[model samples]
Target: MKLFLTCPKGLELLLEEELHQLGVEDTKQTVAGVQCHGDLEDAYRICLWSRLANRVLMPVYQGDAETTEDLYDAVQQVSWLDHIRSEGTLLIDFTGQTRAINNTHFGALKVKDAIVDQIRDLTGARPSVDKVAPDLRINVRMHRGKVTVAIDLSGDSLHRRAYRLQAGQAPMKENLAAAVLLRSGWPARIADFDLLLDPMCGSGTLLIEAAMMAADIAPGLQRKRYGFSRWTGHQKGIWDELVAEANGRKAKGLSQLEISLVGRDEDKSVLRSARQNAERAGVAEFIDFAACRVEDLEREQLPEGVGLLVTNPPYGERLGETQQLMFLYRHLGDKLKEQFAGWTAAIFTSNPDLCKVMGMRADKQYKLFNGALESRLFVYPISERRPEQTVREEEDVVPLSDGAQMFANRLLKNRKQLAKWVKNEQIECYRLYDADMPEYSVAIDMYGDEVHVQEYAAPKKIDPVKTFSRLQEIMTAIPVALEIPANKVILKQRKKQQGSNQYEKQSETHRFKEVNEYGCRLLVNLHDYLDTGLFLDHRPIRYRIQQEAAGKDVLNLFSYTGTASVHAAKGGAKSTTSIDMSATYLNWAKRNLDLNGFSQGAHQQIQEDCLKWLRMQRTPAFDLIFMDPPTFSNSKRMEGVLDVQRDHVDMVDAAMRLLRKEGVLYFSNNYRRFKIDHDALSDYVVEDITFSTLDPDFKRNNRIHSCFKITHKA
Candidate 1:
């Protein structure tokens, strides 16, 4: 008999090898399934033992399905009584319909009509369709005017292992899980490793699969029934013997298997589901599940031995959130480096660009499909020490070319020009380079030992090749001029941004350090957001906030990272209210206040939409308020869009309702094309403070931001 075994599209090779290992021979690989010559016993064994197959099918007939009548006629000729009883439940799974059939549903109906009509004619009773649990399943595939009808030996997809009663969002199919393990060589080398860990185990699919393999347990053992068991052609004696042999092997093998499996996830609900799934799979006692974030995952959680680590982390669905996910990749890399030495990791991810931030060089990579998304399983052999940084850190210091030398000279000139102002103002963090040469077109700033580089987005008219060439030169010139390692530089593109765009995270490294500016020691996170937690350009604004905050109540709106709030707290503001929507940065703000000894009462941090929060405050409460709304913001949390240029009057008026009789509201934004509507603010004394806000470093780029000090006309 010829058998057809179907698996996921990308798992054909692995499935082919798995089928061969299961004592099946003469296998030929095809598009979605493999065709092999096997007896009844071999087919039954494949259904029970083959972990990579979705369905084991027996071809009954093949003919033209170019039209609906042809599809019906082809299915009717398969002799329904030979495989299924007249009154038994049946299901027809049709695929690849022709132009006349149009879709799967219509084609399945046509095939079902023919089978039901034929069974009724033979025995005066037609089989009923039972979608939930069918006695027999008919497989139909129509492709290029051809049709192949087969009996599905496996009632449900083999991927349904019957173990997972609960799962996390977007759980991996069990067969795919098995394929991942096989591709990682875990099954053959289970004895070589002491344990297997999944740090981002959403529902323990990977861990459960690994445990079953290690214990030599067939995944099909726990399933209540297969389609063939109810079919008229099933050989009860042969299948019963295979079952007894599998059960006896599972019992003895599990008793002797010494390897352990551990699964950890950040979500508690999913951890519960993983445990439940493991219990249902009968491997609950062999695997341990825990709720812990990947960054917090440590080697101490494991037994004292090197093992394999496998994780399928959430691939960000949106491209804009690349920075946030990058943070996670780097953090995963950091934890793996800090611990898990002499182990191995198989990290599966669809975002390759984000994976680079992990900083681990893959020893091997395999392409696999997670449904339609083409993903890679990157295998890394963890070493005892951190691998060399991907970026060249200790490049040979060579003399600069003339153009680079000229660029270096201008940098020195800028440093010399700003030296006195920087010293007299007691500023430690400020911009040192801002496109000093048009060719560079990158701003370089210093935050202690770090170099933050922002490449200005070039215009469409400019040649991308030339722009990139200049960027490469700038990358080289910055380190040479600054005498810093290339790794010390954090490079990001600076484009026109709105809402929380600049402040939104890129990486999960959560890497923060203390940096000082104008007598204020604040925290800065370089590995996360597009902008470091501290805005270097806002050095003077923070200082101004500090100067005027004495003996006043302060409110900081859109208080990102709350640097301005820290200024107010330090300058002896009676009380401070810092509001922003992102909990990540708000938590950072709370830490900054603690670093400054202001974590205690009266310094409040509220997570709310600033505009909405401002509107609700009708009482004149704050003595001084700093309002730095983004030029444009349309966060989901907001009731409506916030365009500073269009909504400034209404927003300012709302803020004024909370302002004390003689209070000041310092309004600033980075909208380059902004012009204050002087007529709209006729009722207030609005002072243009953009020029004064710029220190010597930013004197050349007034368009970086605009500031205004608004007060009651009286």
Candidate 2:
């Protein structure tokens, strides 16, 4: 008999191979499934042993199904009396529709009518529809002009191993977990290795599947029911023999099981769920569960033997939150090297970009899907020791061309010019160069010991090769001129940003440097984002806040990392409120506040759109408010697009409504063409403090930003 076995889309080939292992040859692979030739015994074995298939179907009839009547006639040719009794319950699963059969519900109803009529006419008894658990579940398919009706032998999807009654936030299906283990070569490597581990194992899906595979236990052993249990052609004698053989093998396999299995997770609640799932799977005695974080995992925690370490870590659904998980991935990578030596590891994640900073090179990768989300399983062979850095100082030092030397000379001149001011003011971060040479169009900034380079996008008229050559020259000149290690130099592109593009991340390296400004310690990520957390050009504005914010209620709008709020808190402000739409940045702001020993109720960090939050306020509570909105924002999270030039008057008016009678409002933006509507706001006083806010480094480019102070006439 011909059989159709269904599985996930990417597992068709694996399912075919699994069928071959069960002594069923002449198999053909199709999209998301396979077709094979097998007898009743072979089909029963597949239902019991095949871990990748979702359903095992036995085709009973084939005919044309151009219309609903055609479908009804096609289903009637299946010999309903030989499959189900006249008084039994039945279900019809219809898939794919032809031109005449446009609706699946109508098609299923016609098929049901045919089966009920045939049974009643032949045996004077009618069958009833049962969706919950049918005695015979018939599957109908309608192609271009043909149909193939089959009986579903597996009552439920094979992925439903009945082991996971509870799961973590996101759980991997049982069949997918089995596929991951197979692709990771667990069966082939089990003899050489003596252990298996999953550091971030949630609900123990992967662990239980591995145990079943190693012990030769049938995945459907714990299932209480099957589609063939009540069918007339079940062949009770054959099924009973297969069950006895399977039980004997299972008893032998479990007695000889020698490998140690361990599962760990940081969340204690999820660990409890995992233990319960393992117990339900009947493999609890073979596995060990613990509540431990990946960061604290040590070499002593494992047994003396080396084995395979597999885990499924949390992959963020939101792109912005992915940047926040960089450190977590890095920590997992660090522990892989520090704890497990000479062991193989398989790490699965939906976001491969976050794996770039894991510090381990993947030896092999397989594309898999966790439900609708596409993911990858990266396999690495852990070495005896962590790999050494390939970069060396001698290799980076090279001769600079004349053009490169000219750019280097200008950099030295700027550093000499600002050295005295930097020393006297105790500055830790400042701009070193800003498009000083037209040929080398890049801005270089110094953040303590590291350097950040932002190359201006070249015009379309320039040659592509020439543009790349100039960038290479700049990279070589910076380290030599500044006497810094080549690895400390991070480069990024600078272009005109729209909407929230300026706030998006550029890389996966969560390298943050701490800098001091006005006696306030702030954290700045120089590599991950387009803009560092602290704006160096706004040095004077932050210093002014520190001087006059004593005993004042402060509010910081469009607070990217809350650097200004930290300044206010350091100056003894009564309370400070920081608002921003990006939760990624708001969390960064909270960490900055905590680093400065200001983690108290006086400092409140809010995640919301600045404009919407301001309009919702009815009380005049703040004494000082800083409003620095984007030049033009069309972020989907906001109600509407924001044009700083067109909406400044209304934004200021909203802020003024929230301000006390004698309070002040400061507005700023980077739109060079921005013009304040002085006439629209005749009721208040607006002072253009653009020049006073520019520090010495940004003096060359006076139009970098615009600042103004607005207050009520007093």
Candidate 3:
């Protein structure tokens, strides 16, 4: 029989290579899968052991299907009784589209119609559709009017190995983690690397996959269900023998293999999840979990033999993340250089440019994908003999692209343009250049001694290499033009953060710098968070809060780092309350209050969801409230998803309830599509203060955020 093993794009060649190791010959690589000639047992073997395959498919028919009628006719050509039972349940997963069938769902319906009709005609009954847990899964692919229908041998995608009971933020799929291990040639060279370590392991997906592979455990052994089990053509005898063989090998492999594994993460909650996942994978005894920061990785001991270090480090997808994560990358490189003399390290990340900061030249790199975004697996041999690039050379006067030259000229122009305004307004920090030039897509801001450059995520059509080259030129240009050292120039990429991602920590830097905004001395962290302690665009807003805060009981909700709370405390508020879910930021808030020399007698910081805290409030209503919630949040701690645009009404009302009758509720959000929800807040008089909330620097981009002053109608 002919079979195809599907996988993520760019891993087709890797999957084919894995099949070759499994003794399946003549495997041909396709776009996102591998085509091979294999019998039932060979197909089952691939399903059981092929770590990279998303699904194992057995094609039963191939023909043209241009129309609905044509698809039905072609699907009817297959002998239904020989594959699935008429009494059994099955489902169709249709892919691709034709002129007649413009969507997957409609095409799926047509295919289902054909199968049900055919089965009914032959056996006087039809198989029912059970999508949740189908007995037999059928895959139909339509490409350029041609369709190939295959019976899915693996019921669910082979990626679901049933070991990962829980996952950390941005967890890599189990199969992708397995592919990373396989791509490193770890299985074939298991004896070479006795110790596998993941320093930034969140939930230990990589370490668990590595451990399972080292133990020679079959990928599908933990899975209790298979598509072929409920099929009429199932071969129980062959599958039973394969299962027993896999079990015997696993039992023996565990005792014989002396390889050890260790995973570490700074977050204790995250380490707990990794431990639970490892235990579920049944390799808990072989691995150890610890809570440690990347900078402190030197204390961990490396085994006597060759060590393999694999990590899925943070590839800062947003503007602030890149700058903060650069420290992490640099630390990783430093630790590897100081220790692990004879080790192989594989770092998988979507942004390869960030990986360069490690100062370690990648000896081997394979193109792969975490999802839709193209990624790379960079393999480095940690040794004194290995040649690596010096990060200092970033300023070595390389040829600048027209884009880079334009970027530098714009920075100079913006600085010249904003200098007079800065002097007149006494403004220390503001947005300098915000993707003003199309090609050089980045926002350059000066925070006293530091120049923060945020690269806007480029379109897919743009070449990433040219983009980074242009960025490196800008990174070099900023210091020379501004008379600052290269070390003071911070860089990051601006990408829209989604879900509860912004609350998650990017680096364990724990570093903070104090800077002046207007007349207030506020603390800002260029590293460790996507947003610094202060929002530069909201400088005027904080000033407004300060002016209105005197002789009032002030409240700051979602008060990250308590920058606004500090402003309120400094403004002589009779009482101030700061509410936030993150303990880290709350602690920073306390420190910010201390730095400003504010008394703690009436200043309070409550750690919790602002919404929940507001609900518990009744007496001692606040005279002023600054409520700036996240644009969207789905934190596990959150009761439900928070879409600022959708839930702004309820949020505004809740904060209003905590405000005195004559008090003002300053409700604001960075969500671009946010509106004031006039109908929901009919009881309050709403005034749009967004325009008045800007200084000269933010006049170019007033829509970056929207603010409203809401007051109860008297």
Candidate 1, residues 1-714, lDDT tens digits: the string is 988998888898898888789888698999877989989999999888988888999999987769988988988888889988899998999989667988899888998999999989889998998898899999999999999999999989888888998888778888888878877778787767888899889989999999899888998998989989899999999999999999998999789878888888888988999999888888899888888887678788678898898888887775444444666777798788768788888888887766677778999998888888898889988887634542233355456677767777777788788889877877667899898677778888887778887888777687644565466566667788777887797877766687667776676776788987666679987777778888776778888999999989999998888899999989999989999998877888888888889865989899999888887888999999998888898888898999988998888889888888899999998889988998988888999998999888888887889999999877
lDDT minimum window of 10 residues, candidate 3 = 385-394
lDDT over C-alpha atoms for residue 399 of model 1: 62
Compute each candidate's TM-score over C-alphas: 0.68, 0.69, 0.65
lDDT per residue as tens, model 2, 235-339:
989988888888888888889888999998888889899999989887889999998878778768678788999888888774334433555677688777766
lDDT string for model 3 (1-714, tens) is: 899888999888788878888889978988998899978999889888888889999999999889999999999999888988888898999999989999999999998989999889888988899988888899999999899999999998889888877888889998889888877777777778778889999989998888888888897899988878787888999999999999999999888878878898988888898888878877889888988888677634545666788999989765555545666777798788767777989999998877877778889999888889899999998875344334434456655566556666777888898889899988878888876767767777888888877778777687654565566667767776787887788766657778656555656777788898656787888866656778788787888888888899999999988889888877778988999888888998988888888877888898898777767776747999998898988877777788898888888877887788889988888988777778777888999989998777778877889999898888
Which residue pairs collide, candidate 1? 323-506, 323-507, 324-506, 326-507, 327-507, 327-508, 328-508
Native-to-model Cα distance after best TM-score fit, residue 435 in candidate 2, in Å: 12
| Cα error of candidate 2 at position 436, Å | 12
lDDT of 3: 0.83
The TM-score obtained by model 3 is 0.65
Query: Which residue pairs in candidate 3 collide?
Result: 318-493, 319-493, 319-494
